[model samples]
Target chain A: MGRPLINTLRIALHLLIIRPLLRLLFGVNVVGRENLDGVDRFIMAANHNSHLDIFLLLSALPPGKTAKTHPVAARDYFEKPAWLFGIVQFLLRPIWVDRNNSGLAAIKEMQRRLDDGCSIIIFPEGTRGQAGELQDFRGGVGLIARQNPDIPVVPVYLEGPERAFPKDAAFPLPLWNHITIGPPQLIRGKSREITSALYRHLKTLADEEQAYRQRRQPEPHRPFVAAVIGIDGSGKSTLSRRVIGCFKGESCFVGDGLELFTNGEPHDAQPLTINEVRKWMGRQAKSAKNLARYKMRKLAELLLRDRLLSEVERWYRPDHIFMDGSPLLNMTAWAMLFHEEFFNAEVCSKALDILSGKDDRLKKDPIFEQFPELKALRKLNLNHLHLPDAVIFLDVDPEVSMQRIASRGEAVQAHENTEKLTKLRAAYHLVCDVLEQSRPVCRLSGDKSLEQLTQEAAAFIKKVGSGVDETD
Target chain B: MLDAEPSIYSLIVLVLLSVAQAVSLVSKGRLATPASLPVLWGLFLALAVSEWISFIAALWILAIISFCALREYLSLVDIRLEDRWGILFSYFSIPFMFYLIQIDWYGFFIVAIPVYAFLLMPVCVALGGRSRGIVFSVGALDFGLFFYVSCMGHLCYLAFFSERIAMLMIATVAAADLIHRALRNRPRALRVPLQVVVACVLFTGLAEWSAIPLNHSFALGIIIPLLVCLGRFTLKQIEDDLGIRADRLQPGRGRTIDALKSYLFIAPIVFHYLRWFLKWGAL
Candidate 1:
């Protein structure tokens, strides 16, 4: 009972205090946590650099695993008579080894610990390096590893700790550090050959970590908004789903047609029927009065959707928000459907005026005076809906879009035909030209495979979100 | 007394050269190949330190250069485990050679590596009682020490001359290299003569500007270009015999052998001229 209580207290302190403190001080990042999965009994050999290396490595372990892990610290340093040593022993539970004496007893102790199902952390370097470089591995680690051939040895690369705390410095400087864990390697042959192999493995891991760090910059903290716009059957929904799948963590999707945006999830929203779309598109504006009313009603519906989305944004502030289709795309589509030439500044202005409820044409009609709710939406200012952080316009050939829509085995809308899609594709390009004046717009070929489109979309989103292009 | 301060003119020339190299590299959209930056940095340090510090500090820099060159040579060739001690001892002899230059003990510096280092390496390897390829190992170590240490040691001996004269000789070698690189793809008949002509013109002009005598300048004009050609040919032969490309010394970079060969070839010429100027006044 007494031993269990002490172990419990030590784990609690490590998880609650020590781990958070190390992360805060060093900004430590661990790259390969998956390699340690299901690995219970193994020796972790790392390059020794600073006093902080052991702590940084320990912090990377999953909670509750620390109780079964032990670090092989030097007897001369950790066994000294001091309060710090006592705390270290209780918290870290290090196994002490004498460097000057023969390592026979230490090897036996390590084997015994491994037999008891406890993993040990050993620095093959045996001592801290001089200038943060990986030094030659001592033969003692190989001897121990060779004795227990069944127990695998995992090589780890500890970077930036020497710069943080050099051998002669009294205190550490605040610097970013990283811990890269490699796959477990089995020891083979004599001690010298094993040591050489382990040294080469550690050097390769360090070089790979250096390249990875250079390629991956810090992600931004501000919330980003991106939208996918394309003609019908241009793989907008598929591309959006794949792009969202790329983000491993928190992201939210908002807008119409949520049913089409399922990234392997069960579709919840009802799919629009062909009859409803045909009825809307076939209701040709017999006169100027009917066309004006139709435009006002569509504009009011877009504004109301924008108002609801703003409420969702306030309720849940996620890292990213992916809209299936924005109000600007819908407005452009409506203009192309009703007017002869939709790719004009006059149409753009008219769409904006109607959405803002500032158009004199809307007030002159009875449809606007009957709905006071539409007038209230005017104060909401749907201008934010027009601008996104990035726009991914998937440009597909009209014949390909028609073939894809036909193959989906669903009710196809009137606009899904090749003739209409060609015009819609042109209007989408015009929309991109206008939107890109204020935001970043990436054009991707939709005729390619699904995997290729997803990769291109994800790359564009990451580039835009990082704020790398100042022109945006 | 020698001017204790570094020559402002030499510093200005080095700065301008660095800026031009930087602009050219940037315009080409290529990085200063790994070997190019280090060679330029080493030359700048040698010139700057010889002008600012006393002769001893400059000799220490040459000692460091010899150590690095020996390291480069060993890395390129294979040495047995038992022969490591002999190779290490050869590396240790570099500082002693520079120390001889420091004390102005020219006689010992000349013989330290050729006689002592050459004899000591074979004995150390023989002490291990391994006779297989013993001759080859001893020969490789002796040649490395002789070429990288003893031959390069002559550059330290040249520090006794006026800084202006030393800088001018180094610049002449650099001019020869530029001419060689610019005309590398031309016919041998056209390339070799043009290299010599450009090198002679640059050397003569710089020597006259530094107030060197006309005869001495003319002799240097003839000797420096010939040495440059010989050094290039020797390095080419070594590369061919070893089946190693020059760029393999540093990946993602052009060949560094040209700069190294220039340093090796200019050392003896500068040393001879220093001896003449000090012992018999200007030639």
Candidate 2:
């Protein structure tokens, strides 16, 4: 035994060197470490793999307990190199046991340690097994437990040492050393009964820890938000709904802003759903107040859509959020085209600028002089519009898009004609270029058969989901 | 130097990999998983349109990475309250350093953060009228700038000089790190037990198998693993300082910083070594 000074140095070395190595190198996680509390004279039997099993179990003990809690070391393995054994003796203060002589001296030494009100960690497999598979217990631990029935046997499962430092590896990788200590168990039966009970208890802890690690493994990282954008008749509506339907349990359509454009319940303060945009587009230019009203409605719709997407982001965590239109890309594209057609300044852009706290554009334009109530909507600032992580443009030719629109047997909107659709297609192309600089925009031809388009879009989305740059 | 354009063999391999990954996921009953397919398709598109991904575009991607890493680093790691202005301005160094690289001002870009931004942070901290924790605050700020900004800027600089060398360094280092990770816990088929040595050998062999001239493959093979290990050590220390438990290296803030740490650590060291070797060879 060492003197008081040497004992303090060993504890210091363990605290300074061994702990940090476990921390910085292994990122060791100690669960149920507090379970060691109020327990004395216990045998902690753990399944063994790498050499780290001993230190990992020791390091996890309550502070000042490491010195008192000695590990049982084999004489042949530890005593061969005298210097290594000396260091291990000082650090671990382990009780040396000769395996060649089954004279039961080791059990008596362990009982002596237990009688002194100290604990011991024993790997009852006799020797380290291949990293993962647990070996048959040698019944020696059962003798130690039954001899002292009052002493509890603690079961611990060390998760990651097997992989981090496998038997054959030289350089150890930074694998986590997860230590899970279960509740203490007292076995007071025959030697075989005690051994079998201890093994079952250890196996249960191992299974629980293995199940926990499986749950905590790297979850497939995938982006949630994506937009499907194209011309009016390019099958974006049908394709996006199908896209949302593709995922099994968790998927949603984040509001086609044309219909159901309420961030909340349809109250008086909430504007009516201006489902027909072309009607307002034609009527807004007739009167300045009408244009202000149009801007007010479009701004509310986009802001509410932004609000809906955020609500979905917060409370409802879906696997995939399929946004029907992006205000930044699609609505802004419409605004740019509107400015070219009927007015000098686009309405949605002008209205959103005020929401962004830039009301000078609104005040400078003599159109909003009579309306102060609309300016107050700027208080609920949806300034940062939530753009999708990826965009899939269902690019179709103007004539084909018009034919698709006509095939629906619905009223042709002002911009649904071939000439207007041609200009809008060009406008979408320009917006795609600008948006591509940020997120991926896969331009799939929407003119394909419905099955083909659905298949292609779903594949693009899965690729985006399983595949690229979502980490950034 | 490796070719800037991907080879036919590599392209074929990438395509097969893309399809195989898709098939593997679908077979696992994730028939509707929509996020993974685009990643490989995106990779295919990048390689397919190699000429389209110019220096500016590639550098922007790297800059975005540096920006995200700096944000995560500043948020997670300690930057004292008194060092508010100092830490805030540390973010500006990313764009500033990348801008220098964009203009090809090698002299300014190389020293811009370490020499100049290094001086600026301490002064900024001093000007805040707080003396306590100024050293740690300023020191962390300086290291953060140099680590996230200056190191990433060198990769952009390497790309600007020769995209082939930059791509090879990136591809080889990334491939080696991945292979090393995949071999964890699994029995080593390669005779050597040192995963580091095994990964290095594979890195050099992979370069050779690609039929490209990897002149610094040996040097790169060694430095990448060493720097990556050191980088992980630093991240672990930062975790200690934060007193946070990152038990699993799961995909989130920790993983983002982990990838950035190793990849960024490899970049500046390899860049300077290549520059020095190139100069000596010319002489």
By TM-score, who's the top model here? 1
Model 1 CA deviation exceeding 4 Å by range: A1-472, B1-7, B17-30, B240-244, B251-258, B273-283
Best DockQ among the predictions, by candidate number: 2
| CAPRI rating of model 2 | incorrect
Q: List model 1 lDDT by residue over A1-472, tens digit each.
A: 5998998898888888888877654456676878889887888999888898888888877776788889988888766678878988887788778878988888888888889999999998888877547888888888888888888899989876765565765556444466888998888888788889999999998776444221112233445778888887887776787788886445666644332223334333433343244234334321224445656555655555455445445544456667766665666555665564424754554444555344645545433343333344544544344456789998989998888888988666545578778877877887777667667999998768889889888988887887743543
Please tell me which predicted candidate would have the highest lDDT against the true structure.
Answer: 1
Off by over 4 Å in 2: A212-472, B1-283
Q: TM-score of candidate 1 restricted to chain B?
A: 0.85
Structure candidate 1, residue pairs in collision: none
Model 1 C-alpha lDDT versus the unseen true structure: 0.68
DockQ numbers for every candidate? 0.01, 0.01
- Per-residue error for A174 in candidate 2, Å, reads 2.5
